[model samples]
Target: MDLHLKGKNAVILGGTRGIGRAIAETLAGEGANVAVCARNAGQVAETVEALQSRGVKSTGASVDITDADALKSWIRKAGVELGGIDILVSNAGAMAQGNTPEAWTQNFQLDVLGAVNAFNAAEPFLDKAAKSHGDAAFVIIASVSAAQADRADSYGPVKASLIHFAKGLARENAAKRLRVNVVSPGMVYFEGGIWHMIETNQPEFFKQANSRNPTGRCATPQEIANAAVFLASPASSYTTGVNLIVDGAVSNRVNF
Candidate 1:
């Protein structure tokens, strides 16, 4: 499928590894120039090199998303270097799972405010792209846990906030031709990802979680990335203000 992403410029937060890396690679594969940022300098460099090797203009910075000033600066610099930002993927998250105050603060700072700051910093560039190209997109990588409550966890509520914020942003930006959407992935398993840790340390729990899925497995990072990149591409021009779940039917609640 031609995503019509050639020549487009995209910025992805937390793009060094796991799901974020998958999204960055997918976008670059579709010919979008990409700028990525993460806290690990080595991983950032490696991911940037990988993207560039795919024949797309790619740049990356090592910056903590929780540092709002640094994050905004990186976004602006990326726009300048990449020429402009047509797509912004807010994929960073603290993944804080507890109900502790510290966990709540961490999730809020990284997951919620991170997206807020990135969008604010990228808005002007996105507006410009929309004006020139007739379309621009912001894709937030949320989690299916947002709509499910197996326990009291900070992560789920923080993710839910993101979905609410995305819908509101989508409506507000519609007139400007800038689309906003959320991709809520469920139990995406990768070597170094959260599910992998569960699979290793809590084998029985991981097995149960895997069995909960009718597919008898969790999603792959690339599967989630495919949905994210598609939502950010012009191919999904009419798709906005929607929470697209890529959960392999692990989630039983009807979206409606």
Candidate 2:
């Protein structure tokens, strides 16, 4: 399906690798001009180059999403390069699993404030895009951990807050014609991510994790990206203020 996405512009945060990278590639493949950001300049440049090779307009910047000014500056440049943003994918985040105060603070900063920064920076561009494009969208990459109580990590509360944030934005933006939605993925396997940490440091837990899921396997980044593409595209034109769970039915099962 074409998804009617050609020529649209998008800004993606934390897009150097993992699920964020997947979302960038998927949107670009659908013919959207994409701007991606990460902390590492080299990786950002490389990912931008890769996207460019696919015949999509692509740019990258190194910015800390936790800093509001830095995010605003980067968004301004990206909006200029992409000729105005039509879609904003708030994907930057980290898994802070420690139970200490410091870790809790770090998680909130990245998952909550980082998303806020992205939204604030893109608000004007998103307004412009919706006024012009008529089918503009904003997609927040949340997690199924938001709905679960068993998560031992800091990811749970952060994701839960993100869900609320998306809902609030959707409520406020519906009159403006900019659609807001959330995709909550579960147990995604990406290189050097939580899956790798589990496999290397807690093999037994990894086995149990897989067994608990009805699919008997974790989700791939591409699968999560596919859901993102739908929300970002005109395919989900009426979808707003909803959290689409892409967790292979694990979230639906009753855990005994």
Candidate 3:
């Protein structure tokens, strides 16, 4: 199905790797100009090059999402470089896991503040696209853990906040014709960086998660990218303020 996304411009926070990178690739493949930002300057440059090779005008920047001012400036810069911003994918967060209180605090700072900062910075650009341009949307990448709270530092609450924030923003901006939505992903594995910890340190727990999932395994970054594309594309023009869950039924299964 044609997503009707050609020529549109997007800013994907933390799009240097993992799911964010996947989303960037998917969007660029759909013919959208994409700009991604992450702290790793090298990875950011590599991703931009890879996207451009796909024939989409793309750029990359090294910015920390947790810093509000820096995030806002980057968003503005992306809009300028991409020509305009039609989609904002807030996907630059990490699992805050540590056995200490400081670890938990850092988790909230990154998870919650990161999402909030991205949204706040992108709001102006999103509104501009809807009013000045034609159709535009905001797709936020959250996690199924938001619904399950079984993750670190009650990380569930942090993601849950993003889900709710999308809802509220959808409502607030609907009159302006700007759409906001959330995509919740279940257990996903890719490069094996984060997964190494689970598979190596908590093999039993990892086994249970795979068995619980209906597919008997985890989803891929590409799978989650498909959902992000849907939300950000014209295909979902009328859909907004909705939490689209793509968890392979892991969140729905009965846990005993």
Candidate 4:
């Protein structure tokens, strides 16, 4: 499937590991230059090197997404280095699950505001790309938790806010040929990921979660990445303002 993404440039948040890393690799494999950022300097360097191995121009920075000033600066610098930003993938999240004020604040700052700031900083670059290439995209990595209420947690609500925000951005940017969409993954499992920790430390709970999926397993990072990269590609040019769920049927609620 030629995504028609060759020569396109992408900026991905938290792209050093797990789902973010998968997305970055998939985009680079599809021939897009990628710029990534995460707090782990070693991981960031490794990911950038791996992406570059795929024969695409790749760059990375170690920065906290919660730091708006630093994040915006990285985004702008990435745009300058990559020539321009045709795609922006906000894949970082705090994963703060409690109802405490601290949890709420953490989720809001890293998950919600991170996307907000990244998009705001990348807007001019995206606009320029759209004007030149006739298409640009912003794909937010939300979660299926946004639509499910398993407990009283800040994670779900904060993710829900991202969907709402992306919808508005999609509507407002449609005229500019900039698409905005969300990929809501459910129980994606990967080594060193949250689900992996659950599988290791909480065996029974991990089994229960796996059983909840009709597929008898959680999604792999690659599966979720496939959806995200596709949405960010020109092949999905008509798809915008939509939350694409990759939950292996674990979610029962109909989106409509």
How does residue 240 of candidate 1 score in lDDT? 96
Kindly list the per-residue Cα lDDT of model 4 for residues 202-233, writing each as its tens digit.
Answer: 99999998998999998898999999999999
lDDT against true structure, model 2: 0.88
- Error (Å) of candidate 3 at residue 190 is 0.5
**Tens-digit lDDT track of model 1 for 1-256:** 8899999999999998889999999999999999999999999999999999999999999999999899999999999999999999999999987999999999999999999999999999999999999999999999998999988999999999999999999999999899999999998889999999999999999999888899999888899999999999999999999999989898888877
Candidate 1 runs further than 4 Å off:
none
The window of 10 residues in a row where model 2 has the poorest summed lDDT is 247-256
Candidate 2, residues 1-256, lDDT tens digits: the string is 6699999999999888888999999988889999999999999999999999999999999998878898889998999999999999888887777667877888898888888878888889989888877778889988888888764667788888989989899989998888899999999998888897898899999999999899999999999999998998988878888898999998874534
Each candidate: RMSD? 0.7, 2.2, 2.6, 0.7
Model 1 clash pairs are none
TM-score of each candidate? 0.99, 0.95, 0.92, 0.99
Better of 2 and 4 by TM-score: 4
Candidate 3 overall lDDT versus native: 0.84
In terms of TM-score, which candidate is stronger, 1 or 3? 1
* Residue 138 accuracy (lDDT) in model 1: 99
lDDT of 3 by residue, 125-155 (tens): 8888888765689888888877775535556
| Residues forming the 10-long window of minimal summed lDDT in candidate 3 | 148-157
